[model samples]
Target: MALEKFMKIKETLLGVDIGYDSVKIVALRKGNGFHQLRSSNIIAIPPKSLQQKSADLDKIAEAINTARKTARPRISEKLAVSGLPESKVFTKIIQVPQMTDEELKTAVPNEAARHIPLSLDEIYLDWQKLGENSKNSFDVLVVAAPKFLVENYLVLFKKVNLELIAIETKGIAASRSIIKKGEENTIIILDIGAEATGISIFDLGSIKFSYTIPHGGNTLTKSIAAALKMTNEEAEKLK
Candidate 1:
């Protein structure tokens, strides 16, 4: 029927997470009822690439190349979703006066300017209305990701031959992968990677709040190395 055809979902979304120490690729087929996972793989980033503030592009490209080979039989849909590190994204939930959609669209930018320390031109801003608050104002989740960092991901995806469609913070993506639809409880999702740790509180399928700590496994390794007077490699094994 036309209704069924209209509601059908067709695109397969491939998620690529390029972490400080590794690259991960996940492919899923989306349908009207549920999404099915097709493939997933992770590969390590080349040495010294993680030491810099901006990643080394040549090393990143090499990691992606290794990931593609490990994940195998290239994904059918080239369009992909990528995540920014927590350090690169700023998220806040604020209350604003409830108004018409058109009115709120105008007010959101003004409100975002107040909360986000960066200039509007320096970041990509997005907001989601989270219904009304107790005081009759609207509760909105605002997200701001730095433009230069976003551009770096776009360039990386281009080198890997993937069309980038969506860029979300890693906390949101972690909660989405683990949380089920229509869930009524609140849960904290923790993603501990090589160089950073992201903690997100998800309530009823929405992210209530998120925080990223600077420490990760690498930090522990360094601490252990110093305490035990061992090399980094030996401390890693102790972990």
Candidate 2:
């Protein structure tokens, strides 16, 4: 559907990506069978707040409020979807001998024991089949997360009455936006952010490898600030 011809609805969805030094919101309108682009913007959040065990919900609310105000025509939507950073996520690709869909029901626990460090009861686990293997085996990527981190984020959503549709790790969201289906394989997508840079390796329309570099532009700016005796802003400008 064309952008202007898309459905218009009273509902607006705010997508907030909590970054190290800021919170960004890509406000979207939920139309019939689709979402229409309203407006998108970002706001700088206070430091050390997002790093805590619990994020300050007030700050998140404020950032969304700001972005909504800045967009023209104004937005009346309050529902928001938040994204989780990838650093805390634990993921692994596992290959098992040819097994039917029914066979996996019985074999997952055993396979999980060999691959996951925590007992099955200790973690919230999820897995999806990628495709079939050469020898009639199955290829699956198992994802697990600490219960505490998951709950910590849930609290943020509750504070503002913003419904949480789904929480996705940073790598997964970036891959969806950056990687194209049936495109040339072996292409690398690099996204440079404030505290880290994500390196995703796409192969055969799937993300095969995802890595993050601890060193980012901010790190280099900090290095320059300390070495050259300048303020952070000056160091960043020089860089």
Candidate 3:
């Protein structure tokens, strides 16, 4: 597993949002309906090309601690590591015949093989059943991330000494927060994040399809930077 090294959990959770212009870290002492948001802030990245492999794990860890100190000066512990959008992640919902838990258990891997191009051994596959009553067939939400990506993320998390409970997408979190249901109608949710925009269509709370496009606010910033001959920071401020 990617988190095998850094999986030793410490605090509650440290939600790290790696934006194009800035790296934002949020420390949340979660509550029932809300969280204290113990600490939160944005840290500027080095002034250079910020593609993959450009970020230094040590510096990112330092920034997380710095942001926490700036927001809540008395915080004492490191939190769990969060995940970014990995390219290998594939999300889908397929309907299978109703069966017992034992049957579904056996069927999921087989279904994964039919859908996933690579062997199940090459990837970490996770799935959830969305309950019955979707026209008699069971609906399942599935996610697959390449082992390499997971490993890279865990390496960074371990460097920061933050235990990772789960790796999730901001798009999923956004849907959980901002979506408004109207009589169980199908809807497509689009979140224009700094680096990417996600499109997820859900019919009555079940995902039909989910996709992420490379172009986003970051793309716009880069375009503005190139056109206006300005730095990414300047172009981002113009946004």
Query: Top lDDT: which candidate number?
Result: 1
Candidate-wise lDDT, in order: 0.78, 0.69, 0.67
RMSD of 2: 4.6
TM-score of each: 0.84, 0.78, 0.74
Candidate 1 local lDDT, 1-239, one digit each (tens) = 22124224545777788787778788877665756778788888764353344867777978777776767666555767788888668888888986888988889889889988899998898888988787669788989988878777877788878878777888876776588879899899888877778888988788888788988889999999999999999999999
Q: Clashing residue pairs in candidate 1, if any? A: none
Residue 142's lDDT in candidate 2: 68
**Candidate 3: how many backbone clashes?**
0
Model 2 lDDT per residue over 57-168, tens place: 6786677567667766565556555656555556676788887778877676678778766777766777777877676677777677766666766776676567766676
lDDT of 2 at 204: 75
Tens-digit lDDT string for candidate 3 (38-136): 767788765321235545666666776676677754444565645456333677777788888788878888887888777888777788888874666
Q: Give the per-residue Cα lDDT of candidate 1 at 214.
A: 83
Q: Which is the better candidate, 1 or 2, if ranked by lDDT?
A: 1
What is candidate 2's local distance difference test score? Answer: 0.69
Q: Sort the predicted structures by TM-score, highest score first.
A: 1, 2, 3
